[model samples]
Target: MNQLDQLKKYSTVVADTGNVELIKKFSTQDATTNPSLILNAIKLPKYKNLLLKSIEYAKKKNINLKETVSLASNKISVDIGTKILNFIPGRVSTEVDSRLSFNKNLCIFHAKEIIRMYEENGIKRNRILIKLASTWESIQAAKELEKENINCNLTLLFSFAQAKACAQSGVFLISPFVGRIYDWHINKYNLDSINIENDPGVKSVKKIFNFYKKYSYKTIIMAASFRNINQILELSGCDYLTISPTLLSELKSNFNKIDKKLNFTIKNKTYKNKITEEEFRFEHNEDIMATEKLSEGIRQFGYDQKKIEDIIIKNI
Candidate 1:
């Protein structure tokens, strides 16, 4: 079997895209999307008609063009999310506004709104995970949502403290970004290529995996934003992995023998290297790499979101 199939034997593989076509082709177990991916998809020629239809849909409802655009933009995301969930036979993550990353009540309200939209279209809550950032406020937001039994995916994790915080808060899942970590280290050291093993990104997930497995935390770890197939291979036994289309295609072609990189049964499990949340914040703050990357990540996604919103309004 190819490595993708083999990896599935150990961990769930998720498509990391907003493109419904790719999700259908790979048939990933779950799928993830952010503002960037959605913005990227709208540029495709095939989606032009979708934009026009959204405008028309707005007109018939006596809604202004802007409202039509807003409705259509949301519809495109959910429409594709629904498709991915269908093909994958599992959950599909749809994100809330990143600007509300710090407001727990607003996050909960928006999450409920998104869920209501999904349910209105006949999509069940069990198959949808509301994606939120890992800010302290968002963590609190997730805690509340979990009580309502609405699952969540904590994105933009960079430090172990963030991981522990999410687990302690009792979130359903967390996506530790792998590629972004590697990027930080590469740019820090001015390295050209990053190895699958010993890569900082790989190490971050390993740290979280070992911690979660050791404590038997109910919150799942799904490594995201991988830069290469090797990193994906290194994380073969994670709870789940969200991979981009290029790496998925590469993994699809490679039929290498696989071995479990990290698992729950290992002895001598505790790493005394742990630190306090304040310490983690200071450490991450001191590490120019993590700080810069975190800011860049939020900016990049926020930028795309604004761009998409602009296009929607422009047509209105």
Candidate 2:
């Protein structure tokens, strides 16, 4: 069997793209989308109608320009997610606006809005994972949403503290950005290249995987933002690996036998105190890499979010 097929035996493969064609091609179990991916996907000729439809939907709301753009952005995300869901049997992760990441109440409200849009399209809440940033506010918002049976995927996760907080908050999943972590370490060390064995990104995911498995946390770890196939192969046994089309294509052609790099076996059960909000903030701030990358990820996503909104504004 190909490596992609082999990897699926160990971990659920999630397509990390807004392009439905690629998602269909990979046959990923689940799919994830952010502002950037959604922006890129809508640019393609195939999605022009999708964009037009979203604009029309937004116009019907009879809101102001700013509110109309917001509605259209949410509609585009949900529309793309709804389309992706038709191809994948599992859930689709539609991210909340990163601009609302710092506002717990806004985050909660936006998440529910996305869920409502999905449900209106005949998609069940269980088939949607409302993606949110890994800010403290977002985490708290997720905790509340979970109580209402709205599952969430915490994105832009870089620190162990973030992972701990998310799991403790009873989130459905957390996406630790593997490639971003690797990039930070590589630039910090001024290294030309790093081997997969010593890669910081790979190590981070492994640590989180072991910790979650040891404690038997039901919160899933879906490794995201991979730089290459080796990183994906290294995390073969992760709960889920969200891979882009480029890397997915690489895995699809490779026939190498990939071994499970992570496992559920824990010799001894371990326990730790629940992470407090203050502790999460302090520890996460201490990690320079996580702090910088988390901020950078949010800014990038917010920028892309605006770009999509601009497009909607132009058409509407």
Candidate 3:
């Protein structure tokens, strides 16, 4: 069996992209999307019409495209998300606005709006995971949303405290970024003085994985931001993993004999962590890499969102 096939014994593999057309070929269990992926997809010829269609539909209703294309793309995101769920038989993660990460009320409001849009289109709330950043406000907002039975996927996680905090909040899923971990190591150590086997990103996720498994945390850990297959293979048998399409394809093609390396059935283990709000704040503040990446990730997403909005305003 391919590495992807082998990893399936324990871990669920999710396709992390906005393009739904090729999702089935990957045999991904679920799909995830954010403004950046959606923005990238809009540029593709196949997806352009969808963006324009949403814009045109809004134009007909006199809804300002700039303000409304987000609504439109969100609707589009749900449509694609629901469609991919059909192919994979799992939950689809649709992200709320990254700009709203720090705005608790707005995050809750938009999360509900996205869920409502999905529901109207015949998708159920259970099969949808609202993606939020790992900010304190977003975490609080997610906890409130959970009270309403809305499952959330907290993304852009880096620190152990973030994972611990999210688990304590009882979120359905938490995606601790792997590749971004590598990014920090590369930037910090200049990439030349590092050992790939002992790479910081790899060690980071493994620690969280062991902690969650040892403690039996309810929040599933989906390792995200993988730069290569080595990272994925190293972190096999994780709760779930959101891999880019290219890596998924590459993994499928390279079936180098693999086995489930992560032992999930082990008895509960102890991780010296108390993932509270203040703990999360202090931990995040102390980790320069996490702090930098959080700001940089948010800014990049915010910039892309603005760029997409700008495009809609000029064209529609």
lDDT: which candidate is best?
Answer: 2
The CA lDDT of each predicted structure is: 0.81, 0.92, 0.81
| Candidate 3: segments with Cα more than 4 A from true spot | 56-69, 266-275
Model 2 error, position 37 (Å): 0.6
lDDT score for candidate 2 against the true structure: 0.92
- Model 1: per-residue lDDT, tens digit, 1-316? 9888888888999999988889987878899988888788778887777766655655677776655655566666666576566677899998876767878898898788778767877999999999988877888899899998899999988877778878887899999998998887877789997766579888989988888878767899999988778888888889999989998888889988888776777454444554555765676677565577666766776777678778767766
Off by over 4 Å in 2: 266-270
Q: Give lDDT tens digits, candidate 2, residues 182-299.
A: 9998899898879999999999999999998888788999999988999999898899999999999999999988899887786456566888888999999999999999999999
**Clash number for model 2?**
0
| lDDT winner between candidates 1 and 2 | 2
Clashes of each: 0, 0, 2
Give the RMSD in angstroms, all C-alphas superposed, for model 2.
1.2
In terms of TM-score, the best-performing candidate is 2
Better of 2 and 3 by lDDT: 2
Cα misplacement distance, residue 281 of candidate 2 (Å): 0.9
Ranking by lDDT: 2, 3, 1
As a TM-score, model 1 comes out at 0.88
Per-residue lDDT value at 62 in model 1: 76
